[model samples]
Target: MRILIIHQYLWSHYKGKIYSELQKIVNTHKNDELLVLQTSLNEITRANLGPVDRSIHQYNYQVLVDDYYENIPNTTRAKKMLYWVRKFKPDVVNISGYYEPAMNTVLFYCRLVGIKVIISVDSTEEDKPNIWWKEAIKRFVVNRAQGFFCYGSKAAEYMLKFGAKPHQILLENNAVDNQKIASIYKEAYQTRETEKAKYGLRPFNFIYTGRLMAIKNVANLLIAFAKLKPQNWGLVILGDGAEGENLRKYVADEQLEGVTFIEGQAWYNVPKFMALGDVFVLPSYSEPWGLVVNEAMVGGMPVIVSNKCGSSHDLVKNGENGYTFNPYDTDELAAIMKKFVDDPDLIKSFGAVSQSIIKKYSPEQVAQEMYDGFKKVMYEHK
Candidate 1:
């Protein structure tokens, strides 16, 4: 099988990991070939998420465009994507998204060439408002594809509403480099005290490592943390964004104690800072799939994820691995945070469950699932 994957960027660390796993799958199959084409150098989405390490690395198969990441005004993108598709003549094409004009053009080309397409979706109904035109467009385009790949069942469910069949839906479940992230956190855990002291973190800290934007609900987290008034525990907010100063100001005006803000580091260096915390929390009001939760789980730290996150459906086992709460309710968020602080023993137990639950969501597993879907789609489409 000749497989070609179209993705928005190569700069993302987690996506890079997924590519590596896919390469391994190709290597295992004697006649299989895999190639990935990256549309942009870097996109605004990544640029806003703080510092990123854009250093390139060797992969078995990858092609990157010279142009930087921008959605509009890329007049040549359709021509370039069609050129590659014709040259590669892949048996299976997996496009990473549905909304990109470039991808839409490529999908049409694939139809003309008789190549099976597997559309990837990372959205749930909650991610955006339902629009009739968009739904009609998706229903038309999605039905043309032979298979669908997504972050989890929520995304698959969304595809079902778009007229995709149950058998056509494949889970490439969002994942990270479990072993690598776990190893980094393990090494950091040994000297967590020194690390925490260096960052002025408390002995027991709850960490949130993403942009400080409004949709992320960082302000709600602050409100919840403040409600815990005068506790020995601390809250570390990592990453910088438009709401950075506003969040800092809110923390100050509320006189919230032991709340420290660390500017975001590169994806690889996140574990170094994350190891200083005993628990991880993501309070996003809306999230398709939170990959950070997977990182936290692999690092052997329990998570407090908002129920709004898609990963909570798979990675979190309410009261087992971590707790899931309503992001809208500050009181509910505070109660979960207090549980972690009041009983430190739950950290170790819950952390163990986190590691266990995360093992099944590894990049290798996703690669295998993707390969299976490819075979199934090819056979059915034939």
Candidate 2:
């Protein structure tokens, strides 16, 4: 099946879950080109970091775009897309948005020409559009899409407020590349021990990989780490964001001597980091869905995420695979982290369970669900 995807903000450093998953499936399918018509903005959401004006494929580019419609906000981008449509003649048109200004109009026009749409949603309570206009973009445009794929049930709940039917919504998780990353870690560990030892991290380390933003509540993590620093379990902060300086100040003020904040590293280095961590924690105040949760699960570490995170609903099974703590309660995070480190038996059992649970979130499974939904949509709408 020929599929044309409309995902604005394609990054050079790392591709988003949908595009990466689709590419993997398309490669296997052989007949599919998966014509991707994406646009990206040169905007920065972080407070730090000077601009790097290289080609589209340089630096750890910010994947988040402030202008949902990518600044074009007019017919120009839509008109240009038609040119691609004529050449590709995609059987499926997956608009990676719903509430952006010109996005719905573009999808409606595609339908006028006979392409079926499978619009994916990026909605989250933490990242919802401003309450103004009563969320018209979602209520009017999203409800009518052929199919809606999202992170999970939390997204389905939000889409329902927008008048979308439950059946039309399929859960598409922001998952980790299980096979690729794990193999890299395995190879890296077999060759190098000095690299990890240089950072004061021993074999039994705990890691956190993500942006250092306010909502992420890495400060909460530092507090939790303070409770467990006596146990010899080192803490590593992986990604960088606006809250970096504030977090550093807080760490110093708290006198968290053992906690180490390593700025954003290469995305490919994730497995190696994950290998270092005996347990993983994401103490987000209100994360819609964290991709790092998937990484931790696949890497054989017992994960601890906030109940506020959307993915925690599916990913964490409490004592079975991992723990989901209330974000407001630092004590809960501390308890889980201590358990992960103190009891190796529990870690092994939970890690095994996490590995089994990760199968449901694979890219191939999600892509097939998307393809089947597209065919069903065509059968009904045609």
Candidate 3:
């Protein structure tokens, strides 16, 4: 079997790890082959994360454009993608998204050629408001696919609402490289004391790592932190974005001490910062799938994520691993944050559960699930 994946960009370190693992799995099979065609090297929105090192991408892949994804012309992307599809003659085509005109064109061509399509879906129904016309179009496009590789239950449920069958839902786990992150966290843990002193972090730090965008609700996190006003507890906001200056001003205006704002680090270097925090928090009002939560869980840090996040449904076990609160309710978020501050012991206990829960969402496991989905689509669906 030959599998071809059309991805928007080659910038995701998490996806690169999964693709590399999937490639290794494909190689083990005598006649199986896999190839990924990425539209561009990176997306303009992700430029703050810095250049993606090409050396880490170990899978068989071709970059269709050297520019950012948004800058790539649709016609050029469609032509290059079609050229690769025709040349490869793949048995299965997995499209990363449906919104792009180029991806839609490729999907149409694949359907017309009788080649099975497996849509890789990360969007949940709650990610955005549903307009009737847009939902209708989504239904039309979704029904054309033979299979789906969903990021989580929320994504699978969203696809089901759009007329995809349960059986067609193939791979459900969206993951990062757990072993790599855990290993990095372990090494960083060795120098934890030095790093903590270097960064001037407090004894107990609640860390949020990601772009400081409006949707991330970092201001709400600040408000929650202010409500506590604990001397020993710190709030670490890592990553720079459009709202960086505004958040800093708000923090200064409120005179919120023990709050540290660090610029974004490279993907590989993020876990090093993760070692400084006791618990991880993602208070996003809208997040499809928070892979940062996965990284935190792998690093054995309990997470306080918004219920709106897709990962909260799959990864968070409520009070077990960590609590999920409504992003809109600052009081609810504040109460949850106080849980860690009041009883410091809950951090270690909850973090232990986080590690155990995250074990199943490893790159190796997700790659095997994807390989199984490819086989099922190629054989059973036929």
Candidate 1, residues 248-359, lDDT tens digits: the string is 9987887778999999777878898889888999999899999999999998899999988888887889899899999999999999999888899999999999999898
Clashes of each: 0, 0, 0
Question: Superposing every Cα of model 3 onto the true structure, what RMSD results?
Answer: 0.9
Model 2 vs. true fold: TM: 0.83
Error of 2 at 240 (Å): 1.8
Off by over 4 Å in 3: none
lDDT for model 3:
0.93
How does model 1 score by TM-score? Answer: 0.95
lDDT of 1 at 199: 77
Model 3 weakest 10-residue run by lDDT = 48-57
Candidate 1: segments with Cα more than 4 A from true spot = 48-58, 62-64
| Top model number, TM-score | 3
- Supply candidate 2's per-residue lDDT for 160: 76
As for candidate 3, its clashing pairs are: none
Query: Which 10-residue span in candidate 2 carries the lowest summed lDDT?
Result: 56-65
Considering TM-score, where higher is better, how would the candidates rank from best to worst? 3, 1, 2
